[model samples]
Target: MHIVVCMKQVPDSAQIRVHPVTNTIMRQGVPTIINPYDLFALEEAMRLRDRFGGEVTVLTMGPPMAEDSLRKALTFGADRAVLLTDRFFAGSDTLATSYALAGALAKIGEEFGKPSIVFTGKQTIDGDTAQVGPGIAKRLRLNQLTYVARIAELDLAAEEITVERRAEGGVQVLSTRLPVLVTMLEGTNEMRRGTLEDAFRAARTQVVTWSAADAGITDLTKCGLRGSPTIVKKVFAPSARAEKAHQIPTADLSFEALAEAVMGEIFARQPAIEGDLMRFSSGQ
Candidate 1:
Protein backbone atom coordinates (compact mmCIF):
# COMPACT_ATOMS: atom_id res chain seq x y z
CA MET A 1 0.00 0.00 0.00
CA HIS A 2 2.52 2.56 -1.10
CA ILE A 3 1.32 5.99 -2.20
CA VAL A 4 3.10 8.61 -4.29
CA VAL A 5 1.99 12.22 -3.97
CA CYS A 6 2.98 14.80 -6.54
CA MET A 7 3.57 18.30 -5.27
CA LYS A 8 4.79 21.58 -6.75
CA GLN A 9 6.36 24.76 -5.50
CA VAL A 10 4.59 27.78 -6.93
CA PRO A 11 4.82 31.53 -6.54
CA ASP A 12 2.17 32.96 -4.23
CA SER A 13 -0.55 34.09 -6.60
CA ALA A 14 -1.53 36.99 -4.34
CA GLN A 15 1.99 38.42 -4.56
CA ILE A 16 2.66 37.59 -8.19
CA ARG A 17 3.34 40.46 -10.55
CA VAL A 18 3.57 40.82 -14.27
CA HIS A 19 6.32 42.77 -15.94
CA PRO A 20 4.88 45.98 -17.37
CA VAL A 21 6.87 45.78 -20.58
CA THR A 22 7.45 42.06 -21.08
CA ASN A 23 3.98 41.05 -19.92
CA THR A 24 5.57 37.98 -18.39
CA ILE A 25 5.30 36.87 -14.80
CA MET A 26 7.84 38.54 -12.56
CA ARG A 27 9.03 35.73 -10.31
CA GLN A 28 11.82 37.78 -8.84
CA GLY A 29 11.18 38.86 -5.24
CA VAL A 30 8.07 36.70 -5.17
CA PRO A 31 7.71 34.28 -2.28
CA THR A 32 7.09 30.63 -3.05
CA ILE A 33 4.72 28.23 -1.31
CA ILE A 34 3.49 24.69 -1.79
CA ASN A 35 0.57 24.67 -4.21
CA PRO A 36 -2.53 25.02 -2.06
CA TYR A 37 -4.43 22.50 -4.14
CA ASP A 38 -1.66 19.95 -3.73
CA LEU A 39 -1.96 20.25 0.01
CA PHE A 40 -5.33 18.55 -0.19
CA ALA A 41 -3.81 15.67 -2.09
CA LEU A 42 -0.92 15.42 0.33
CA GLU A 43 -3.21 15.40 3.33
CA GLU A 44 -5.39 12.81 1.71
CA ALA A 45 -2.39 10.65 0.95
CA MET A 46 -1.19 10.96 4.53
CA ARG A 47 -4.62 10.03 5.79
CA LEU A 48 -4.65 6.94 3.63
CA ARG A 49 -1.18 6.01 4.75
CA ASP A 50 -2.23 6.36 8.36
CA ARG A 51 -5.20 4.12 7.81
CA PHE A 52 -3.47 1.51 5.66
CA GLY A 53 -0.08 1.39 7.42
CA GLY A 54 2.16 2.23 4.50
CA GLU A 55 4.76 4.82 3.54
CA VAL A 56 3.79 7.99 1.67
CA THR A 57 6.39 9.50 -0.64
CA VAL A 58 6.23 13.05 -1.88
CA LEU A 59 7.67 13.76 -5.34
CA THR A 60 8.23 17.04 -7.18
CA MET A 61 9.97 18.24 -10.35
CA GLY A 62 11.43 21.69 -10.51
CA PRO A 63 14.62 23.65 -9.84
CA PRO A 64 16.80 22.78 -6.85
CA MET A 65 14.65 25.07 -4.74
CA ALA A 66 11.76 22.66 -5.11
CA GLU A 67 13.38 20.59 -2.37
CA ASP A 68 11.77 23.06 0.00
CA SER A 69 8.34 21.79 -1.02
CA LEU A 70 9.43 18.18 -0.59
CA ARG A 71 10.78 18.96 2.85
CA LYS A 72 7.51 20.66 3.66
CA ALA A 73 5.72 17.48 2.71
CA LEU A 74 8.02 15.50 4.98
CA THR A 75 6.96 17.72 7.86
CA PHE A 76 3.38 16.75 7.12
CA GLY A 77 4.22 13.06 7.78
CA ALA A 78 5.47 11.99 4.38
CA ASP A 79 7.90 9.11 4.88
CA ARG A 80 10.16 10.17 2.04
CA ALA A 81 10.75 13.04 -0.41
CA VAL A 82 12.18 12.85 -3.90
CA LEU A 83 13.34 15.85 -5.93
CA LEU A 84 13.60 15.50 -9.70
CA THR A 85 15.58 18.38 -11.09
CA ASP A 86 17.53 18.80 -14.30
CA ARG A 87 18.63 21.54 -16.68
CA PHE A 88 16.97 19.76 -19.58
CA PHE A 89 13.56 20.03 -17.93
CA ALA A 90 13.34 23.80 -18.16
CA GLY A 91 10.36 25.45 -19.88
CA SER A 92 8.47 22.16 -20.12
CA ASP A 93 4.79 22.25 -20.92
CA THR A 94 2.29 19.73 -19.64
CA LEU A 95 3.26 17.14 -22.20
CA ALA A 96 6.98 17.26 -21.49
CA THR A 97 6.41 17.53 -17.77
CA SER A 98 4.21 14.44 -17.80
CA TYR A 99 6.85 12.57 -19.79
CA ALA A 100 9.64 13.46 -17.36
CA LEU A 101 7.49 12.75 -14.33
CA ALA A 102 6.31 9.44 -15.68
CA GLY A 103 9.90 8.37 -16.25
CA ALA A 104 10.79 9.47 -12.75
CA LEU A 105 7.86 7.55 -11.35
CA ALA A 106 9.08 4.42 -13.06
CA LYS A 107 12.51 4.94 -11.59
CA ILE A 108 10.95 5.50 -8.20
CA GLY A 109 9.02 2.28 -8.49
CA GLU A 110 12.18 0.39 -9.30
CA GLU A 111 14.30 1.95 -6.57
CA PHE A 112 11.58 2.05 -3.97
CA GLY A 113 8.53 -0.19 -3.90
CA LYS A 114 6.02 0.07 -6.71
CA PRO A 115 3.33 2.52 -5.69
CA SER A 116 -0.26 1.31 -5.58
CA ILE A 117 -1.64 4.80 -6.07
CA VAL A 118 -0.40 8.16 -7.32
CA PHE A 119 -1.99 11.36 -6.11
CA THR A 120 -1.96 14.92 -7.42
CA GLY A 121 -3.88 18.14 -7.04
CA LYS A 122 -6.68 19.17 -9.35
CA GLN A 123 -4.42 21.81 -10.83
CA THR A 124 -1.57 24.17 -10.15
CA ILE A 125 -2.19 27.80 -9.34
CA ASP A 126 0.46 29.07 -11.77
CA GLY A 127 -0.46 26.84 -14.68
CA ASP A 128 -4.11 26.07 -13.87
CA THR A 129 -4.28 23.88 -16.98
CA ALA A 130 -5.28 20.73 -15.03
CA GLN A 131 -3.65 18.55 -17.68
CA VAL A 132 -0.49 17.24 -16.03
CA GLY A 133 -2.24 14.62 -13.87
CA PRO A 134 -4.17 13.18 -16.79
CA GLY A 135 -1.11 13.41 -18.96
CA ILE A 136 0.93 11.46 -16.48
CA ALA A 137 -1.79 8.85 -16.16
CA LYS A 138 -2.01 8.53 -19.92
CA ARG A 139 1.73 8.13 -20.29
CA LEU A 140 1.95 5.65 -17.44
CA ARG A 141 -1.08 3.68 -18.57
CA LEU A 142 -2.79 4.04 -15.23
CA ASN A 143 -6.48 4.36 -14.47
CA GLN A 144 -7.18 7.98 -13.57
CA LEU A 145 -9.78 9.69 -11.39
CA THR A 146 -10.06 13.47 -11.49
CA TYR A 147 -11.76 15.92 -9.18
CA VAL A 148 -12.08 13.34 -6.42
CA ALA A 149 -13.86 14.81 -3.44
CA ARG A 150 -13.61 11.88 -1.05
CA ILE A 151 -12.10 8.46 -0.58
CA ALA A 152 -14.98 6.36 0.58
CA GLU A 153 -13.39 2.96 0.95
CA LEU A 154 -10.17 1.04 0.47
CA ASP A 155 -9.92 -2.73 0.44
CA LEU A 156 -6.23 -3.41 0.71
CA ALA A 157 -6.57 -7.15 0.54
CA ALA A 158 -8.78 -6.86 -2.51
CA GLU A 159 -6.56 -4.12 -3.90
CA GLU A 160 -9.49 -1.87 -4.65
CA ILE A 161 -10.42 1.75 -3.92
CA THR A 162 -13.71 3.61 -3.98
CA VAL A 163 -14.11 7.38 -4.10
CA GLU A 164 -16.69 10.09 -4.53
CA ARG A 165 -15.88 12.04 -7.65
CA ARG A 166 -17.17 15.52 -8.23
CA ALA A 167 -19.07 15.84 -11.47
CA GLU A 168 -21.33 18.18 -13.34
CA GLY A 169 -24.68 18.56 -11.45
CA GLY A 170 -23.85 15.75 -9.00
CA VAL A 171 -21.24 13.35 -7.60
CA GLN A 172 -20.21 9.99 -8.99
CA VAL A 173 -19.18 7.07 -6.80
CA LEU A 174 -16.39 5.16 -8.52
CA SER A 175 -14.44 2.06 -7.65
CA THR A 176 -11.16 1.01 -9.19
CA ARG A 177 -8.30 -1.37 -8.66
CA LEU A 178 -4.81 -0.56 -7.46
CA PRO A 179 -2.19 1.26 -9.58
CA VAL A 180 -4.45 4.23 -10.18
CA LEU A 181 -3.90 7.97 -10.45
CA VAL A 182 -6.11 10.51 -8.69
CA THR A 183 -6.33 14.27 -8.95
CA MET A 184 -7.78 15.49 -5.68
CA LEU A 185 -10.09 18.48 -5.60
CA GLU A 186 -9.44 21.40 -3.31
CA GLY A 187 -11.27 21.93 0.02
CA THR A 188 -11.86 18.19 0.40
CA ASN A 189 -9.92 18.15 3.65
CA GLU A 190 -7.91 20.58 5.74
CA MET A 191 -4.16 20.25 5.91
CA ARG A 192 -2.80 19.26 9.30
CA ARG A 193 -0.11 21.12 11.19
CA GLY A 194 3.15 19.31 11.72
CA THR A 195 4.19 18.34 15.21
CA LEU A 196 7.44 19.63 16.66
CA GLU A 197 8.96 16.16 16.37
CA ASP A 198 7.87 15.87 12.75
CA ALA A 199 9.32 19.29 11.96
CA PHE A 200 12.65 18.36 13.54
CA ARG A 201 12.74 15.07 11.65
CA ALA A 202 11.95 16.86 8.38
CA ALA A 203 14.74 19.36 8.97
CA ARG A 204 17.23 16.54 9.33
CA THR A 205 16.00 14.23 6.56
CA GLN A 206 17.95 14.29 3.29
CA VAL A 207 15.82 14.56 0.17
CA VAL A 208 16.56 12.09 -2.62
CA THR A 209 17.69 14.07 -5.66
CA TRP A 210 17.51 12.77 -9.22
CA SER A 211 18.44 14.38 -12.51
CA ALA A 212 16.92 13.53 -15.87
CA ALA A 213 19.48 10.84 -16.45
CA ASP A 214 19.10 9.51 -12.95
CA ALA A 215 15.37 9.31 -13.51
CA GLY A 216 16.00 7.21 -16.66
CA ILE A 217 15.02 9.91 -19.11
CA THR A 218 17.32 9.53 -22.13
CA ASP A 219 15.63 11.32 -25.02
CA LEU A 220 16.68 14.91 -24.67
CA THR A 221 14.39 15.88 -27.54
CA LYS A 222 11.37 14.97 -25.37
CA CYS A 223 12.43 16.75 -22.20
CA GLY A 224 12.44 20.53 -22.18
CA LEU A 225 11.58 23.39 -24.51
CA ARG A 226 12.18 21.23 -27.56
CA GLY A 227 9.54 18.77 -26.41
CA SER A 228 7.05 21.46 -25.47
CA PRO A 229 4.73 22.13 -28.41
CA THR A 230 2.69 24.82 -26.72
CA ILE A 231 4.02 28.34 -27.19
CA VAL A 232 3.05 31.38 -25.20
CA LYS A 233 2.82 34.30 -27.57
CA LYS A 234 1.54 36.81 -25.10
CA VAL A 235 0.56 37.11 -21.42
CA PHE A 236 -0.88 40.39 -20.26
CA ALA A 237 -3.23 41.65 -17.59
CA PRO A 238 -6.72 42.62 -18.60
CA SER A 239 -7.22 46.33 -19.23
CA ALA A 240 -9.29 48.25 -16.71
CA ARG A 241 -12.79 49.02 -17.85
CA ALA A 242 -13.62 52.66 -18.59
CA GLU A 243 -17.09 52.67 -17.11
CA LYS A 244 -17.84 52.35 -13.39
CA ALA A 245 -20.40 49.92 -12.00
CA HIS A 246 -23.91 51.29 -11.95
CA GLN A 247 -25.44 51.45 -8.49
CA ILE A 248 -29.16 50.97 -7.97
CA PRO A 249 -30.85 53.00 -5.26
CA THR A 250 -32.80 50.84 -2.76
CA ALA A 251 -33.86 53.20 -0.04
CA ASP A 252 -37.58 52.37 -0.16
CA LEU A 253 -37.70 49.48 -2.62
CA SER A 254 -39.40 46.18 -1.72
CA PHE A 255 -37.94 42.80 -2.67
CA GLU A 256 -40.05 42.56 -5.83
CA ALA A 257 -39.22 46.14 -6.83
CA LEU A 258 -35.53 45.49 -6.13
CA ALA A 259 -35.65 42.38 -8.32
CA GLU A 260 -37.36 44.32 -11.07
CA ALA A 261 -34.84 47.15 -10.79
CA VAL A 262 -31.93 44.69 -11.06
CA MET A 263 -33.50 42.99 -14.06
CA GLY A 264 -34.20 46.36 -15.70
CA GLU A 265 -30.63 47.46 -15.16
CA ILE A 266 -29.27 44.21 -16.61
CA PHE A 267 -31.55 44.41 -19.61
CA ALA A 268 -30.67 48.08 -20.10
CA ARG A 269 -26.97 47.29 -20.10
CA GLN A 270 -27.37 44.35 -22.48
CA PRO A 271 -30.58 44.35 -24.51
CA ALA A 272 -29.68 40.98 -26.03
CA ILE A 273 -29.84 39.39 -22.59
CA GLU A 274 -33.52 40.38 -22.24
CA GLY A 275 -34.34 38.96 -25.66
CA ASP A 276 -32.43 35.75 -24.84
CA LEU A 277 -34.29 35.45 -21.53
CA MET A 278 -37.60 35.91 -23.33
CA ARG A 279 -36.69 33.29 -25.89
CA PHE A 280 -35.56 30.89 -23.17
CA SER A 281 -38.79 31.40 -21.24
CA SER A 282 -40.73 30.66 -24.41
CA GLY A 283 -38.76 27.37 -24.83
CA GLN A 284 -36.95 28.59 -27.88
Candidate 2:
Protein backbone atom coordinates (compact mmCIF):
# COMPACT_ATOMS: atom_id res chain seq x y z
CA MET A 1 0.00 0.00 0.00
CA HIS A 2 1.16 3.52 -0.77
CA ILE A 3 -0.20 6.79 0.68
CA VAL A 4 0.32 10.33 -0.55
CA VAL A 5 -0.07 13.21 1.94
CA CYS A 6 -0.44 16.76 0.72
CA MET A 7 1.06 19.46 2.92
CA LYS A 8 1.44 23.23 2.68
CA GLN A 9 3.78 25.81 4.14
CA VAL A 10 1.73 28.68 5.53
CA PRO A 11 2.49 31.86 7.42
CA ASP A 12 1.90 31.63 11.14
CA SER A 13 -1.54 33.13 11.70
CA ALA A 14 -0.49 34.70 14.99
CA GLN A 15 2.26 36.61 13.25
CA ILE A 16 0.36 37.47 10.08
CA ARG A 17 -0.08 41.10 9.08
CA VAL A 18 -1.89 42.88 6.30
CA HIS A 19 -0.10 45.38 4.12
CA PRO A 20 -1.57 48.83 4.76
CA VAL A 21 -1.24 50.23 1.26
CA THR A 22 -1.59 47.11 -0.87
CA ASN A 23 -4.35 45.48 1.22
CA THR A 24 -2.59 42.13 0.85
CA ILE A 25 -0.93 39.69 3.23
CA MET A 26 2.47 40.85 4.48
CA ARG A 27 4.49 37.67 4.16
CA GLN A 28 7.91 39.28 3.84
CA GLY A 29 8.89 39.01 7.51
CA VAL A 30 6.29 36.49 8.67
CA PRO A 31 7.50 33.10 9.90
CA THR A 32 6.17 30.06 8.11
CA ILE A 33 4.97 26.73 9.49
CA ILE A 34 3.12 23.70 8.20
CA ASN A 35 -0.62 24.33 8.14
CA PRO A 36 -1.90 23.22 11.55
CA TYR A 37 -4.81 21.29 10.03
CA ASP A 38 -2.41 19.38 7.75
CA LEU A 39 -0.55 18.06 10.76
CA PHE A 40 -3.62 15.99 11.66
CA ALA A 41 -3.71 14.57 8.14
CA LEU A 42 0.02 13.81 8.26
CA GLU A 43 -0.26 12.09 11.64
CA GLU A 44 -3.21 10.04 10.42
CA ALA A 45 -1.33 9.04 7.28
CA MET A 46 1.72 8.01 9.32
CA ARG A 47 -0.50 5.97 11.64
CA LEU A 48 -2.15 4.21 8.71
CA ARG A 49 1.24 3.45 7.16
CA ASP A 50 2.52 2.07 10.46
CA ARG A 51 -0.45 -0.26 10.79
CA PHE A 52 -0.65 -1.37 7.16
CA GLY A 53 3.09 -1.45 6.36
CA GLY A 54 3.56 0.99 3.50
CA GLU A 55 5.61 4.01 2.49
CA VAL A 56 4.11 7.47 3.05
CA THR A 57 5.21 10.22 0.66
CA VAL A 58 4.68 13.86 1.50
CA LEU A 59 4.16 16.38 -1.31
CA THR A 60 3.97 20.19 -1.37
CA MET A 61 3.81 23.03 -3.92
CA GLY A 62 5.50 26.25 -2.93
CA PRO A 63 8.57 28.41 -3.36
CA PRO A 64 12.12 27.12 -2.89
CA MET A 65 12.02 27.99 0.82
CA ALA A 66 9.08 25.59 1.17
CA GLU A 67 11.62 22.78 1.03
CA ASP A 68 12.11 23.37 4.77
CA SER A 69 8.54 22.27 5.43
CA LEU A 70 9.06 19.03 3.43
CA ARG A 71 12.22 18.27 5.38
CA LYS A 72 10.26 18.70 8.60
CA ALA A 73 7.70 16.17 7.36
CA LEU A 74 10.50 13.74 6.58
CA THR A 75 11.60 13.97 10.19
CA PHE A 76 8.14 12.75 11.14
CA GLY A 77 8.83 9.45 9.30
CA ALA A 78 7.64 10.22 5.77
CA ASP A 79 9.40 7.90 3.33
CA ARG A 80 9.78 10.56 0.64
CA ALA A 81 9.25 14.30 0.06
CA VAL A 82 8.55 15.94 -3.27
CA LEU A 83 8.65 19.71 -3.84
CA LEU A 84 6.78 21.22 -6.77
CA THR A 85 8.01 24.73 -7.42
CA ASP A 86 7.87 26.86 -10.54
CA ARG A 87 7.66 30.51 -11.53
CA PHE A 88 4.39 29.83 -13.34
CA PHE A 89 2.73 28.56 -10.14
CA ALA A 90 2.92 31.83 -8.21
CA GLY A 91 -0.27 33.69 -7.26
CA SER A 92 -2.41 30.60 -7.78
CA ASP A 93 -5.82 30.41 -6.20
CA THR A 94 -7.60 27.22 -5.21
CA LEU A 95 -8.49 26.22 -8.77
CA ALA A 96 -4.98 26.70 -10.16
CA THR A 97 -3.44 25.10 -7.10
CA SER A 98 -5.59 22.02 -7.46
CA TYR A 99 -4.80 21.84 -11.16
CA ALA A 100 -1.07 21.97 -10.60
CA LEU A 101 -1.22 19.57 -7.65
CA ALA A 102 -3.35 17.08 -9.58
CA GLY A 103 -0.85 17.04 -12.41
CA ALA A 104 1.99 16.59 -9.93
CA LEU A 105 0.15 13.71 -8.29
CA ALA A 106 -0.16 11.96 -11.64
CA LYS A 107 3.57 12.43 -12.23
CA ILE A 108 4.30 11.09 -8.74
CA GLY A 109 2.21 8.02 -9.43
CA GLU A 110 4.13 7.31 -12.62
CA GLU A 111 7.60 7.93 -11.18
CA PHE A 112 6.88 6.31 -7.82
CA GLY A 113 4.26 3.64 -7.21
CA LYS A 114 0.62 4.50 -7.71
CA PRO A 115 -0.87 5.61 -4.45
CA SER A 116 -3.92 3.81 -3.05
CA ILE A 117 -4.99 6.82 -0.99
CA VAL A 118 -4.37 10.57 -0.98
CA PHE A 119 -4.68 12.59 2.22
CA THR A 120 -5.04 16.33 2.84
CA GLY A 121 -6.18 18.59 5.65
CA LYS A 122 -9.70 19.95 5.96
CA GLN A 123 -8.33 23.36 4.97
CA THR A 124 -5.28 25.57 5.10
CA ILE A 125 -5.12 28.38 7.65
CA ASP A 126 -4.19 31.07 5.12
CA GLY A 127 -6.79 29.93 2.57
CA ASP A 128 -9.62 28.47 4.60
CA THR A 129 -11.84 27.91 1.54
CA ALA A 130 -11.56 24.12 1.91
CA GLN A 131 -11.87 23.71 -1.87
CA VAL A 132 -8.52 22.26 -3.01
CA GLY A 133 -9.10 18.73 -1.75
CA PRO A 134 -12.50 18.40 -3.42
CA GLY A 135 -11.15 20.11 -6.50
CA ILE A 136 -8.40 17.49 -6.80
CA ALA A 137 -10.96 14.75 -6.31
CA LYS A 138 -13.10 16.18 -9.08
CA ARG A 139 -10.19 16.64 -11.49
CA LEU A 140 -8.83 13.14 -10.84
CA ARG A 141 -12.28 11.51 -10.57
CA LEU A 142 -11.48 10.02 -7.17
CA ASN A 143 -14.00 9.31 -4.45
CA GLN A 144 -13.81 12.18 -1.93
CA LEU A 145 -14.51 12.06 1.80
CA THR A 146 -14.22 15.48 3.48
CA TYR A 147 -14.19 16.35 7.17
CA VAL A 148 -13.26 12.80 8.10
CA ALA A 149 -13.01 12.48 11.89
CA ARG A 150 -11.79 8.91 11.99
CA ILE A 151 -10.86 5.97 9.81
CA ALA A 152 -13.10 3.25 11.22
CA GLU A 153 -11.82 0.37 9.15
CA LEU A 154 -9.58 -0.45 6.19
CA ASP A 155 -9.91 -3.73 4.27
CA LEU A 156 -6.95 -3.76 1.91
CA ALA A 157 -7.72 -7.11 0.34
CA ALA A 158 -11.35 -6.11 -0.16
CA GLU A 159 -10.25 -2.62 -1.25
CA GLU A 160 -12.74 -0.80 0.95
CA ILE A 161 -12.38 1.97 3.54
CA THR A 162 -14.86 3.03 6.23
CA VAL A 163 -14.65 6.45 7.78
CA GLU A 164 -16.58 8.48 10.32
CA ARG A 165 -17.38 11.79 8.65
CA ARG A 166 -18.30 14.89 10.62
CA ALA A 167 -21.56 16.44 9.51
CA GLU A 168 -23.56 19.42 10.77
CA GLY A 169 -26.29 17.21 12.25
CA GLY A 170 -24.25 14.19 13.26
CA VAL A 171 -21.46 11.81 12.27
CA GLN A 172 -21.91 9.94 8.98
CA VAL A 173 -20.27 6.54 8.54
CA LEU A 174 -19.16 6.30 4.91
CA SER A 175 -17.62 3.42 2.98
CA THR A 176 -15.61 3.85 -0.21
CA ARG A 177 -13.26 1.87 -2.41
CA LEU A 178 -9.54 2.39 -3.06
CA PRO A 179 -8.06 5.53 -4.71
CA VAL A 180 -10.05 7.89 -2.48
CA LEU A 181 -9.06 11.40 -1.39
CA VAL A 182 -9.69 12.27 2.24
CA THR A 183 -9.64 15.69 3.94
CA MET A 184 -8.90 14.98 7.57
CA LEU A 185 -10.47 17.09 10.29
CA GLU A 186 -8.39 18.84 12.92
CA GLY A 187 -7.89 17.48 16.49
CA THR A 188 -8.43 13.91 15.22
CA ASN A 189 -4.97 12.82 16.40
CA GLU A 190 -1.81 14.30 17.92
CA MET A 191 1.41 14.45 15.89
CA ARG A 192 4.38 12.43 17.17
CA ARG A 193 7.80 13.90 17.87
CA GLY A 194 10.65 12.77 15.65
CA THR A 195 13.58 10.86 17.07
CA LEU A 196 17.18 12.09 16.81
CA GLU A 197 17.93 9.40 14.23
CA ASP A 198 14.93 10.49 12.15
CA ALA A 199 16.11 14.12 12.25
CA PHE A 200 19.58 13.10 11.01
CA ARG A 201 18.09 11.06 8.21
CA ALA A 202 15.83 13.94 7.18
CA ALA A 203 18.79 16.33 7.09
CA ARG A 204 20.69 14.00 4.73
CA THR A 205 17.71 13.10 2.51
CA GLN A 206 17.38 14.79 -0.87
CA VAL A 207 13.98 16.31 -1.53
CA VAL A 208 12.93 15.70 -5.12
CA THR A 209 12.26 19.04 -6.79
CA TRP A 210 9.97 19.43 -9.82
CA SER A 211 8.94 22.35 -11.97
CA ALA A 212 5.61 22.64 -13.80
CA ALA A 213 7.03 20.94 -16.88
CA ASP A 214 8.65 18.17 -14.88
CA ALA A 215 5.31 17.57 -13.13
CA GLY A 216 3.74 17.01 -16.60
CA ILE A 217 1.71 20.21 -16.58
CA THR A 218 1.29 20.93 -20.27
CA ASP A 219 -0.91 24.03 -20.24
CA LEU A 220 0.80 27.14 -18.96
CA THR A 221 -2.45 29.10 -19.09
CA LYS A 222 -3.99 26.87 -16.40
CA CYS A 223 -1.18 27.31 -13.88
CA GLY A 224 -0.89 30.65 -12.10
CA LEU A 225 -2.64 34.04 -11.98
CA ARG A 226 -4.07 33.51 -15.45
CA GLY A 227 -5.91 30.40 -14.27
CA SER A 228 -7.14 32.02 -11.03
CA PRO A 229 -10.49 33.74 -11.56
CA THR A 230 -11.21 34.81 -8.03
CA ILE A 231 -10.53 38.47 -7.31
CA VAL A 232 -9.78 39.85 -3.86
CA LYS A 233 -11.38 43.27 -3.51
CA LYS A 234 -9.82 44.02 -0.19
CA VAL A 235 -8.06 42.30 2.70
CA PHE A 236 -8.22 44.15 6.00
CA ALA A 237 -8.55 43.51 9.70
CA PRO A 238 -12.05 43.87 11.08
CA SER A 239 -12.62 46.99 13.15
CA ALA A 240 -13.22 46.63 16.85
CA ARG A 241 -16.87 46.43 17.86
CA ALA A 242 -18.41 49.43 19.66
CA GLU A 243 -20.46 47.37 22.09
CA LYS A 244 -18.76 45.33 24.83
CA ALA A 245 -20.07 42.06 26.27
CA HIS A 246 -22.41 42.46 29.26
CA GLN A 247 -21.33 40.42 32.24
CA ILE A 248 -23.96 38.47 34.19
CA PRO A 249 -23.75 38.10 37.96
CA THR A 250 -24.15 34.69 39.59
CA ALA A 251 -23.35 35.45 43.19
CA ASP A 252 -25.63 33.77 45.81
CA LEU A 253 -27.86 32.35 43.14
CA SER A 254 -28.91 28.73 42.60
CA PHE A 255 -28.22 27.08 39.26
CA GLU A 256 -31.86 27.22 38.14
CA ALA A 257 -32.29 30.77 39.47
CA LEU A 258 -29.06 31.84 37.76
CA ALA A 259 -30.33 30.34 34.51
CA GLU A 260 -33.60 32.24 34.88
CA ALA A 261 -31.70 35.45 35.59
CA VAL A 262 -29.64 34.99 32.47
CA MET A 263 -32.78 34.36 30.44
CA GLY A 264 -34.39 37.48 31.93
CA GLU A 265 -31.36 39.55 30.97
CA ILE A 266 -31.46 38.15 27.44
CA PHE A 267 -35.19 38.83 27.14
CA ALA A 268 -34.72 42.36 28.44
CA ARG A 269 -31.98 43.00 25.90
CA GLN A 270 -33.95 41.54 22.99
CA PRO A 271 -37.72 41.26 23.46
CA ALA A 272 -38.03 39.50 20.09
CA ILE A 273 -36.09 36.57 21.52
CA GLU A 274 -38.68 36.19 24.32
CA GLY A 275 -41.49 36.35 21.74
CA ASP A 276 -39.74 33.73 19.62
CA LEU A 277 -39.26 31.48 22.66
CA MET A 278 -42.93 31.84 23.64
CA ARG A 279 -44.04 31.04 20.10
CA PHE A 280 -41.71 28.07 19.94
CA SER A 281 -42.94 26.73 23.31
CA SER A 282 -46.59 27.10 22.18
CA GLY A 283 -45.73 25.40 18.84
CA GLN A 284 -47.01 28.35 16.87
Best by TM-score: 1
C-alpha lDDT of candidate 1 relative to the true structure: 0.93
Give the Cα-based TM-score of candidate 2 against the true structure: 0.86
| Candidate 2 lDDT tens digits, 182-210 | 99999999999988888999989999999
lDDT of each: 0.93, 0.93
Residue pairs of candidate 1 with colliding backbone atoms = none
lDDT of 1 by residue, 1-284 (tens): 78999999999999988888787888999999999999999999999998888889999999999998999899988989999999999999999999999999999999989999899999999999999999999998888999999999989899888999999999999999888999999999999998888899999999999999999899989998999999778767889799988789999999999999998899988999988988899995
C-alpha-based local distance difference test score of model 2: 0.93
Off by over 4 Å in 2: 20-22, 239-284
TM-score of each: 0.87, 0.86
lDDT of model 1 at residue 104? 92
